[model samples]
Target: MGDVIRTVKVKLDVRRERCDDLHQTKDQFLHCANTTAEWAWRHPDEYCVTSKQKAETALYDRLRDETELTANLVQKGIRRAIEATKSGVARLKNGETTSQPHFDAWSVVYDKRSATFHRDHVSLSTVNGRIECPYVLPDDPEQTPIGEYLLNEDYEFRMSTLQYDRSSGEFYLHARMRRAEREEHEQSTTAFSDAEHRTVLGVDLNVDGSLAVTSTGAFIGNADEMNHRRREFEKTRGSMQQTGTRSAHLSIQSMDDREHRWMQNELHRASNQILEEARDHECTHIAFENLTDIRDRMPGVKRFHAWAFRRLYEYVEYKAEMLGIEIEQVSPAYTSQRCSKCGFTHEENGRSKHQFACQKCEYELNADYNASKNIARKLLKRLHSGQTSSSGGAPCQCALTSGTLNLNGEFIASVDSTAEGESTDKPTTSVVGN
Candidate 1:
């Protein structure tokens, strides 16, 4: 497998007297970044300074003379500005309204050249000079948070960001770490190379209580809690906006960052849970509903909800790729309304908020779970169709906890119904198709 990059955040033990030096360094870095961003923002027509090489050539020496930041720090600021410019340009091209990127946050990016890691202390470059600061690590490595990422030999050190928490008056270093995938993952991938032996996991994203539901009967995240937090943020922002004070505006920015971090943390947890569920089910691939024109389908969904869905998918996509597992997207059509057991399709089948009951077969299950199974079946059908045309292979079959579904048009389950229509737990075959 290939290398995987992850970030670990650790609190720093900085002397109160030395904290001012770091603050000054952060201020200089912000000034340099904003200066570069302002210059790039002036070029609306040409969309210039989006490239690292062009940005360095145009603003590197100028920032060095204008700010007190060191050479590496100035380069990092330029890189940050270029990334923002590129994002802004892309959004504008997509007909989205966006303003020039601005950096008001109190954070500084540090690369290997500007930072040194020791056993217990880290030396960082500041405006004054290099200062050595101790890490707030526990006595035992196992007791440390993200200890594997911080102290493991397998992880290689990369760039980091220095951030100050105003609420706690603490300095934190978010260290980016890289490591290769485990050998077992490679072996497992090889075992799944045969299409006949492959298993797939399907996930359904929703804005209800559950954020994601997997075909293997696993629910990943809490959408209700996320929506509650979003509402709280909106209420607080509205009150602060009405105040019309500089401190209120600054508080709004800090609150926005906190909310974003919290949302991202939730999404990360959800994505990790999805990966675990896939592994638990021995799934070689994970399938999700295609998100194209999602807004048109679910017009009531808020912008942040759509953003969360996209970000969650991205997190899962990368994590799955690291383990050599493939990700697939299938058409979302009729997934919510179609019955997983009988393949009955009707709009009224999804009448209930949390439960789904097939109008034709009386099949009942959780709505999201039913949709997830349909997503899996759709992907299986698509894959099998291609395989049949190309290699004349056997039909695609996926094993559920209680049954096996053959994409050739039948579902074989261990459970069956008697003459009176009561479940008898006997083997039977059901005709199931799109």
Candidate 2:
């Protein structure tokens, strides 16, 4: 395992009189970052800059002349702007629809030179000067123990962000801390370094039916229940809108809030379920389909359902990282139609919404389950071949609790894919363009 970095979020107890200073600082930082981003976007040559030296050489002086930010804060803003611009440019190059980077959030970055850490309070730089703001730890035990890690000597503080929540009228410091990797975690991760030894959990997400299905034959989340709840919300909202009364509009607002909270809770539970499945199976990695251009791929899916897939992946990603399990995304190109049994490639293979029957090999299984097996195979293929291989190659294998699937996708007793020799040549199964 490598060194671990964690972000600690705790409220900042700031007096009313000092709030304006922070507001001004955040506004200036936003202006600086956006201005720098706009300039970089206009000139891609400048935005391709990655190193701190290049960023300083290109944006440092210009940002300083435009804003009242200090040298350290100005540098931080320039670096942040560079990152945003690079990400946007990369996404655009990848053929993903994206707009120019924009910074509109109420946030300010502080480095060691600009901020000081104390037991009870943090000294932060603002437009006025350095201000000592006490930390407000969460009262609930279930919440993150802010003091447990922040005050520990083993963790070293890094650059952090100061943010304000307009609705709560509270300021927060997202402090980044790092510590060396633990010996036990290193031992566990050493096993992951071996491609053939690693156990992977393949997850398939859907808009209808079950939300997520694993290669291990575990299904999670009820899309029907979620759709029913959403329909009820829509029905209630429509009725309130027809009433056209002030109280009805207020009720509609409350209903929207309630629905959002419920959706978040559902997604969190689904993510937790996925983590449990991976851990139960002793998987080193969890594989998912690449969600880029998901809307185009799933043209019939609603916007909310598409958003749910992305949100669920994000939730699982952070939670999985804590357990030293890695998340991997495989190509979504032929995962559905390609047969996990004989590496057959045909459109009709995934015959229906729920069933997958390969045309060449006559292999049949649940459609999502088959796709999930393909997802796991894609990752395993990449690990063994050092690249993502064509879907028509020798079929990759998967491990189950009682048995493992062979190249033909039969349930025979085995351990890992290495137990059998895989063919380097393509399969005889008829194929179509991917």
Candidate 3:
């Protein structure tokens, strides 16, 4: 069977007015909670049985009577609230638990503080005969520019963003656009065309500041820089907690925002670099570990784990697609402890902060690099062997080349191809240290 190829691009545009209005809407929804609570208290017996629609209608009526909100706006707000309740219920049934069930959705009603509607070209669908609702673009326009470019020209491009310096009144896009053509023979399908063959590169990322590249037999990069920044952030946070002063709190908040922006930029750069390198190696398919489950492994630190894993995977997947590469995910079982050199399983191999020394085969290497090799090998083996393992160990048998050389006096040249057929050829001679 051949693969399906589709292109999607995203662009983001943030208007200052929209951002401020969104924030105000959020604040108003928070204030409305007291209204809901007071009503629930007065009619405790009816609260549970009252449908969300009925509750919202009654609340709107009371707000209208008090001149807190206009009748038309109140009705619009109620309808939005009802939709939110339905969404919350659906999410709960799907096993997602949250302390703030209906919080965020409630704010959508107030999203447009200053509503504008276009008559000639209707921008939004009329809701209950009211045209002053927040507009959902025909398609998500924020990211549509890139999608249009990719689809229209059948080429890949890089897309990135930069925030405005509000104090300085400076706006910067900082977009690094690189367009590339896929130099492969195209095959026609029933509905569309397909590439002759595709390459899948599996990536394994770790919070310990290392990224595993399955296709290259190399650790792409580590998060040491990020870790350093995080440590600084934590120190500042702790110092602020100790101070307990208003000025200290303000400083801490500023620091937090700055650190967050820095971290986001760094992550974006790292993810882009990874994909760019993969493209250079002619990778057409990109794969990653199923991070949703890997996140569950951190029971107490689930929130942090979820944030890190999701951000990395999301960036990689979207960026890969923008580069005309397909992305997939596989199980993340023992990609680290299993040996890529030999099919030796080291179930009892105790790892330190940096090294993964396999007890069974006495193989030693940087833990993240070893894991990456294992991930690439296992995925390729799965594609070729068509075998499933109940034990959940990463499959061995990646066509990898590795050797240790004495750098004292000899000259050597070598070429090694990974499981995905990515070749690295280098010739070198070494001199002893002076």
Candidate 4:
């Protein structure tokens, strides 16, 4: 087994007094970080001379005295900023564009040495004093204990960031823990699971079918009720915002939190279900469209909420990694309208938003289903050719159309958009990493 990092989010159980203290300290920590980065940015000459250790050593005393933050937290903030500054300088040296990393008063980092976790409570050091907060899982109300990994004695606690969202009035502690993980890449060598035995699950995602269509013939994520609830919330938000009273505003905020959590919970369920499908079928690889900047190209009726598509892709990515399912992003061009039956591209082939009919041949299929097959074909080409770049396919002139929707049909909700893991060209097996 090798090292794998996992982030366990446990809500802080601090009362108002301690919570306020933590918030105040978080502000100071952010200010200290950004301020230090600004210093490094202005003094590029000194950057070459000063190592991260030297920069941190010079800033620690000044930051602690000025910001009233503790030693460890101040040092950590400055160290983080130094790392950012170093990155920016390197980018400039390489003739690449660079921008300074900026931070504000919303979140703070807590090094492993700065906190202690017990069975139920965690004691954290701040500028004021050591505050103890029992962690809480946001959606789970029954006070169910945190995950077993968090409590595992052998797990290494590296560092975590504590952030408070003003809109939801919730505190989140993202604790990153390290454990051992190892997987044998023996599929190609195994006699039972050779080229013929390998299963490639190609998935095509679209607004027409929120549930993705797969090459293996399964549609995932049919949560129309979720969409209905989102539309209702939007309508309610529109009506409520008109009143504009303080109480009405507060009620709206609470409603927004509920809607956001509901959407997140629902999407999590969908991601899990998708992973279960892969696991059950022993899917070795899952292929998806490289939907990076998809909105810029086709801002049409067939695009779902951008956040939903992005979040689903990200969630599926990490979840797939956990199940040892490899993920790759193929070219988005021709995935939607290209005919999988005969590789025909005709405008009339996509007869309707939901149906695809080929003009050259009598081939017909569900629009999304046809698209999924094309995605699978693209993946197969990559596999056989040993190419890693995006597929170099011509764009389809035909467009998938969806009927117009009024205000009621639109889904709107403010939600958490932080991707759990950082994007990487070289994929890693770990669940948590940047």
Candidate 5:
């Protein structure tokens, strides 16, 4: 059976005394981790992949006598520290030593064998003692509680980490678990899963907003409003920096976390809306531009920072994976400058910010819409050329679609097409002429 790894967050409600005990244990854990790392850093003769297990065994035997900590945690800390040092050495050997690993956080790692879970509470092994804490689950009426879900036969318990969130003053437990892959496809829910019915949805992400245009529909986010809010926050940060007071500096420090959370919510909402559009359109394949080198192409745009785009893509990616959708990121070369109609590339084709007009062919359309079509075409070419994912499935049929998707989940269109059995004014593949 195929496996999927997922991380779940649980809120920890422990007694004040237990909290203090856990905090002190975290200190000890970090201290031991640093010590192990430093020892590995100083001793180059004792490191080898073949003897890593032996090294861990020796460290385990020696650490137990030195630190008054649990057995599993000590092993994990030492192994993790050594692995971290090895990674640093590799990076340095590659001629890049901008930063090294630091054991800055205070936390405890727990394996499944040492931890136990009940319906809504959990017991963790700490140096002071085993502390029991109840967790708060999200408001999902359709799903069972996390604890009960873990107890199911199909689910497997995995490693977990208990950490203290200083800002919230509450304990949080993050558990990494796995489960057997579900059969979301072949159940008559989506066209991508059905062999005969398939379509590709091309998504274009811009600093102003995002556009997901498919054969039957398109989704657009409220990027302008989101950008406005971000700029306002940036101005506030600028003012705070100007004061240069201790309080101002503290405010500046606190702004990052708050802004990050806000950006995350905004991006998540946008991605969810796009996925909903794809589902409605029955699109099986989703294509996005590989923006790895986008920084060099368009620099100094705060909204287009690599992390922002990465986070947005990650949200869509995980959601897509859960639904059996095939996704690929094509190289971004001239999606914006090239004309989708006559294959003409010119510097002046996209002189305007919102519209694209081919100087040679005189074909005009929305700039993002044109880019979306190009992205879809790129993937279609790859699909027909026998460049499928490792599973090596055949290509899916798709139509070139165009339109606008508003934040209110409303789709306004200049051109639209209907899914396989739906009634609409337009036919699929109307523009691609396939």
Candidate 6:
């Protein structure tokens, strides 16, 4: 069976103008309530109210004559207030801690001088194209007048409505504004097949401008462009900080925003490219370094490392999911320092940035390649040992053709060339961090 997926969204504080309109609507409702109460007192036999609904209907009729506010918005406000009250009651029944009951929507009332809305006690209902809130309205001289309140300025508008499918017994709310457009492409629902059918691709990212992939060895790419832009931004920000001028501050802010947008886009593109290449090669599983603990391990300059590590992981996961590729996280301990050919671990083994020569086994290789090989080996071991959740689930291995390798006896170097008889050149080796 396929897994169930759902998308949840929350929209917070909206415009204040909508809120003000709601408040004014409430004030008109109270004026109607006071008139009804006075009529009921003078003619008790003719205007007898048995239920709250009766009073609410009367209030709605009176309010409709006084204001131009739409009936839909007023009803929506009343329904929201009632829902809040119901939610509070449910929480108390579940033995949850809660505060005292407060009025979710204010009721409008009229006095000799002006109209006002009181938050204490109010009954709301929708009738005859108006919202009816029948309650005793407060008449204080110090209180702000309802006529001064602006529509959509003090109150925000929210819509909530339920739709039910009788055939499927499914019910859901079709509410909230469309803030962002949804992608048209349908997502894949197939679960990943067993271990034998999948090949895991491990990727190692570093700040020194390199990307190491387990299956294809190492490639060069980095946040160097982002770093350069950031440096330029910092200079502008420094000048702005010294000047304390409005124009300089605005310029600095604009530059910072531009830099962030560019960097984020670039990172997304690079991560997606790498994942697509792996999928094209028939690798269904992807592995990455678990960088959560890296900050504690390396203390100083923690903020920089945290940002880079999080951005890389987020991009990889998002791209992998979109491509229907499964991702795994492996411990990053000693992946760079250990020898790939032989199982030897030593701090001095990696003497330079680009070179790694194991002291115990005397095996030497490019630093990035060594790390890639280690990552791949670790993933394979985990899969074979049944330590992974998706292990032993399927048996669909990809068929790969063998290639010829040219060996350089001088440095014990080996290079694999394509099947099309294309010649492979050895890379110029340079020692870094000597």
Quick one: how many clashes does candidate 6 have?
Answer: 17
- Cα error of candidate 6 at position 119, Å: 47
lDDT of 6 at 314: 55
Number of clashes recorded per candidate: 0, 0, 6, 1, 0, 17
Which candidate has the highest lDDT of all? 1
Better of 1 and 6 by TM-score: 1
Provide TM-scores for the models: 0.52, 0.52, 0.45, 0.47, 0.48, 0.48
Please list the C-alpha lDDT of all candidates, in the order they appear.
Answer: 0.76, 0.73, 0.46, 0.62, 0.64, 0.46
Q: Which stretches of candidate 3 lie over 4 Å from their true place?
A: 1-194, 209-215, 298-302, 349-353, 358-362, 381-434
Q: How many Å off is the CA of 372 in candidate 3?
A: 1.1
Window of ten residues with lowest summed lDDT in model 6: 403-412
lDDT, residue 91, candidate 6: 70
The alpha-carbon lDDT assigned to residue 387 of candidate 4 equals 63
Question: What residue pairs clash in candidate 4, if any at all?
Answer: 2-181
Off by over 4 Å in 6: 1-195, 211-215, 218-220, 298-302, 393-434
lDDT, candidate 1, 144-234, per-residue tens? 5457777876776777899999999999988888776787445644553544455667889998778988776677799999999999999
Best of the two (3, 5) by TM-score: 5
Candidate 2 structure quality by residue, lDDT tens digits, 1-434: 57778898889999999999999888888877877776667543443444544555466545655776665677678778879877877887798876667888888898666788765679998778889999986675344556566766677677788999999999999988877677744564455343335566788888878888876667788877888899999998998899999999999999987887788779878988888877766676788999878888865567778878876886687567558676779888899999876889899998688888889978777788788878877776665454532222323445443344544456554344233322121211111010
Q: Candidate 2 clashing pairs?
A: none
Write down the worst ten-residue block by lDDT for model 2: 425-434
Per-residue lDDT tens digits of candidate 5, residues 292-390? 777777644463456666666766765675576777788767888988667798889989877788899788777776777677667766765667632
lDDT of 1 at 281: 56
- CA lDDT of 270 in candidate 1? 93
The superposed Cα distance between candidate 6 and the true structure at residue 17, in angstroms, equals 35
